[model samples]
Target: MSGSDVRMSAWGAVGLVAGREVSTRVRSKAFLATTGVTLLVLVAFTLVMKFLGGTGGADATVGFAGQTSVLEASLKATATSVGQEVETRAVADEARGREQVSDGDLDALLVGDGTSIQVVVKEELDAELRTALTVLAGNIELNQQIVDLGGDPGQVNQRVSQAAIDVRPIEAPRDFNGEQMVLGMVAGILIYMSLLINGQSVAQGVVEEKSSRVVELLLATIRPWQLMAGKVLGIGAVGLLQMGVIGGVGMGLAMAVGALTIEVSAAVGTVVWLVVWFLLGFVAYSLVFAALAALVSRQEDVGGVIMPPLLLVILGYVLGISILPGDPGNRLVEVLSMVPLFAPMLMPMRLAMGGVPAWQAGLAVVLVAALIPALVWLSGRVYRNAVMRSGAKVKLTDALRSA
Candidate 1:
């Protein structure tokens, strides 16, 4: 009987093939090593960032000359408030202050000149010191003005120091912050890696099967599409499980480090979104990779033939972390997010950075979802013809040309 005539149900065939693929790959050493290493690196990076400390707490030493008691007090108080350590030393003269700063003995030196102040630094003043000095100078000038206008400088200073501005946005998205950016990046990287790694897994599997004549044996009972679908599904299942581990570990690590605090509902929703996109991206790219691999008989040739799709994945990721982080509203990002090849990577990035309308995300989903079956059908046709061919690499045009 023909393979198709004797084959079990389509779902059964695909599942049988998928099951085999999953079992084989999961047991492989490379998958285990890479997954463990990736998780370790994730944990290591988070711990490093958490314990490394931020820009605050660094010491800034300032040398002063002439009458500057008020400015020195203001500087010390400001630095303390902003979590900066400022050390002040009395210099005999301006020349001595400059010498101290030039000799690296002081970060900066302030010289009182009548009502104005001049600062000397070896290079540029440190940002914390600069801010403190500016505030101090402004307050001094304001106090002089208040005293000249027959008002109490001390009372004005108290009122000014107590005043603060609170900002409230009229229409803001739900608490999207630096933590969300990190999570979004993690999501994008996960998708990119899965697509690049598992998609290539499909390609390499195709090339290996063809090279060893395994395709002929497998094709004995199942159709070409079934084989392709099973491989993609099986490998994608492995990818999904790997992604779940990575995502869970990442979320747990982030929370453990106090870097991220997310609502249970929102966290669950994000996880769902990530899984959905990963499946879509895997299906979209895996079929194409498998079809492309079928055109090349050698493993080495897989990389050369897969350049186009690989570039698309790279471009999407590059845009995701770089441009999307800064300008989520960029015309290019908006345009690309709707395209099937780039949407899986960019749409999550956009959603994470906030300001993306529900419809735009929905539209991107609809477009990519609508395109997968068509892609599967087309890729299956290419694979059916190309898998049987051997020797020279099959041109895409030649593969698509119906016999």
Candidate 2:
């Protein structure tokens, strides 16, 4: 028999469609270009962050005069206590100190005569520097008072140094820190982009097939739902593969560069959650895109019909990245994390923050999982009726009624 006359199993047909989609799109220049560009951007971003600075101790250069030894020692000790490093230069000439400070050779110029201290800067001093100077001044005054009261400052300092306080936690939190926060934000972005880009691809593909009269030939052999399912599944598989590569490579690069400071287990967990949410988010949006795109016979009308799904994705992304970071425990965030429409974005963020209870996360999964079947049923109905119509645009109401 000819290719068109051959009878194929339902699974076989879907696989054929999916394989066709994967091969065609994955080999396309557009796909490779976008992936390459994203990898480059991620690498560049990591480099920029490293170049800006890491969590290493702060450093400052200071020039001092007039009884500089004791005061310099005090400043160094204070700064060192706070994980800061201060380099001291004894400038005997005040004029030379001022000129060096003006020329950017010194962060600040300190003029002290035992009991009193003065700091001169070309411009406003940073809070760290100001704090270091303030601490040095206080220590000098304390020493003077101790001497006046017939006490030894060294003995007092030695005694205070040996005193320490212990802190205990009633309930220890999960390992959520700056690196984990970054990982979470990255996951959210991946979800948003996966749904947005691949959903649009599905819509555009559906519109193209209809406009070109390709669906009629395919529908002659396979049912409409199978075609729709095949298309979404195929495109979504591509998206999943892309997301996996991006997540793996991005995390690997981050760890290699010391950008990701979280532990290995945490990183692996973050990646696992990212993949799960990506699948959930992609499936939720792709079918909706296919159904909506059926209403349009041409590529030009695709944008106007897909607004609702697009808006939902954008809203979720905004909430995930913007408000959720600063206020992960906000009542609104907690509520949204359980909502099917917003869960894909918000849930991952709450997970990253590490305070979400198991029940809440399971509930979110159940809600999102439940919505998929209903959406699939509705979109399948829409696709069956509208996939055949040609020429003018079809209304969603008419599509549902006719189906």
Candidate 3:
């Protein structure tokens, strides 16, 4: 920056600083390395999910022996009706089928020449498979009884199959989509990594300049808040771009690979929300990080200064990742996600889970948005007061009081 830069307006100074940061960091090898690593990880994940069949693996494998081969399709349909995916294979005879089951080639084997459904398992039967088999056996018995009574067994079974209870739910329950759950989880991981990594980039940048006394030189031209805001905005822009690329490319790969079978709109919505929350979370956390980092001129002490807020980020992510997958309606996580401090990590995950009320999502965004101005004022004061004073770690009270 030149001496004439001191005479520039605040916007001009900030733009100049921001421009410098963007140009410098975007060209750096660290940025390239991290972005490359992230993209590779995404590609690997997409491929793995595609190969593994995208959140639906066979619940069990069943082998049909002898004349039981005719029963394979009905058995599969029955398993599916009970929310199980049972893959079936043919065996030459009951002896071979039992051997396959014992050798773990199949989860269960059907035997006894298809007169009735008989299963042999190496161990105990799975509860789900048991339910499906019980239902199948009941249908068979009912058909036999109808045949003995001279009724059309097929017509009677069809009527029985069509019987469904009239469900009168007061409010419709949200059916969590498989794709949404996976997408939400991926969203959480992406945002958490972004905030932890890029948020620190903001702080480390501040400490590096201060420790190197480069801040003093820069300050000669630009005002303190302008310098601070420029750093945040500049780094933020780069991070946002990087994040957008990862989210877009990851979603695209999943879609192309058939791993994400959801509608394009849902996938696009997830990416958009990911970007939105990232901006909000990044700005909110970066402001505080930049301010706290100003208190300590050394890179090592930056961690000490930022640990409290860092824990909040980690806590939010942990709660979201651990609990939300099991119980997306977790009350505590729901309430905490509404808090601005935790919203960045948790809200995006819940949003990706695909059933959040419109008001709730809007409120979380609004809360975080409202908190940004307060952070700007508070962070600006500490950054301004402490950025110029470098040496031993400055007390938080002194930074605030002196300002």
Candidate 4:
């Protein structure tokens, strides 16, 4: 056969092997059942969160005494603005209001003495209530100061209005407060688990094939690189499919519970980045795993061989969590997020949190994409050199020499 014909034949064999692996995994009952169970669990968790938040809002009851019509009106408006239906009760006296609060009949008591305002609660007030009251009190105090200083109320109001500047976001703005945290956490967990599960499958498959001598028969028809590529592609396909199902279920639950809100568009963009990065990360890790698997004839040595990549994955996750609450634009965070190994976890998080510049995100993705080919080439060389050897355990030096 001519060189081109030989290359075409090899590519065809690789496609066939990959196709078989994909088909086998897709058709497995285990995959279907796991997907179904996971979807149900996610839906249940979303429902629980929604119910808890709803209940928390419903449980607050505030009493007001000695408050003027203006103060009451302002409090009501503020509560309405934040989507809270405050249970506002008019109390005849401060003593009664404080008594009700102490007895738990009222969550909090708002007392206005004309010159000063006080909030009396059983203990800690609801966070939402506290925030609303604080803003309202600040406005009231400012207006009083303007009147006391002989300034026109209209002019004071205009100054206050002008002081309220629109908060322009430096990065792409997200509509939801905590959506980035949820998205980053979910994506990181999924990627970490998928890598560990799928990489182990690749290692086990290699060990099993070798132990059963099936690899010898397969090698006659396919090159080591083709076998490795097929396994990686097949498993990668399965991982993507699983992630798609999870994403669909999560989106559905979010929408059902109003968690999606205006942030759905942002979340969709994050997921797109997640899938792209996941593919690159999987290839980098899986190739290394496949190569390591080839170093041992027995399945037992697979764990030890896979340790370095696993440790890297763990470290990435730990660092991602550590830096999440801090400035994502910090030099250390930026450096970590751009590195190929940690980019899979950190870049997605930084993107979701509105921390990364567009150019930096683009550059990080490109850098990771560029690393995959080098990793594949190195791993293929390692596999070809070590797969045929029978040994207790192959040292890295020996493997490199053989390669």
- Using lDDT as the measure, which candidate wins? 3
TM-score of 2: 0.85
Error of 4 at 42 (Å): 1.9
Predicted candidate 1 versus true structure: per-residue lDDT over 247-318, tens digit per residue: 888777867776566665666667788888999888998889999999989999999999899899999999
**lDDT, each prediction:** 0.85, 0.85, 0.91, 0.79
| TM-score of every candidate | 0.79, 0.85, 0.88, 0.81
The numbered model that scores best in TM-score is 3
Task: Write down the worst ten-residue block by lDDT for model 2.
Answer: 49-58
Angstrom error of the Cα, residue 400, model 3: value is 1.5
Task: Please write out the lDDT profile of model 4 over residues 101-215, one tens digit for every residue.
Answer: 9899998888866445578888798989887787777777877888989888768667765786678887764332465666676677777777777778888888878878888
- List RMSD in Å for every model shown: 5.4, 3.7, 3.4, 4.7
Error of 4 at 153 (Å): 6.9
Clashing pairs in 4: none
Off by over 4 Å in 2: 1-7, 54-59, 63-67, 71-103, 111-114, 120-124, 150-176
lDDT of 2 by residue, 1-403 (tens): 6768867899888888888899989998988988889989988988776666575434789998766655777888988886678889988778889999999889888875656778879898978878877887788788889999999999998998899998788866445466656767888888888888898999999999999999999999898888988888889899888888888898888888987767788778877887788788888888899999999898999999999879988998898788866765678878988998889888887786677889999999998889999999999999999999998888889999993
User: Where is model 1 poorest over a 10-residue stretch in terms of lDDT?
Assistant: 49-58
Candidate 3: where are CA atoms >4 Å away? 1-6, 54-73, 87-114, 118-131, 146-152
Candidate 4 TM-score versus the reference? 0.81
List the pairs of residues colliding in candidate 1: none
Evaluate residue 98 in candidate 1 and report its C-alpha lDDT on the 0 to 100 scale.
Answer: 88
Candidate order (TM-score):
3, 2, 4, 1
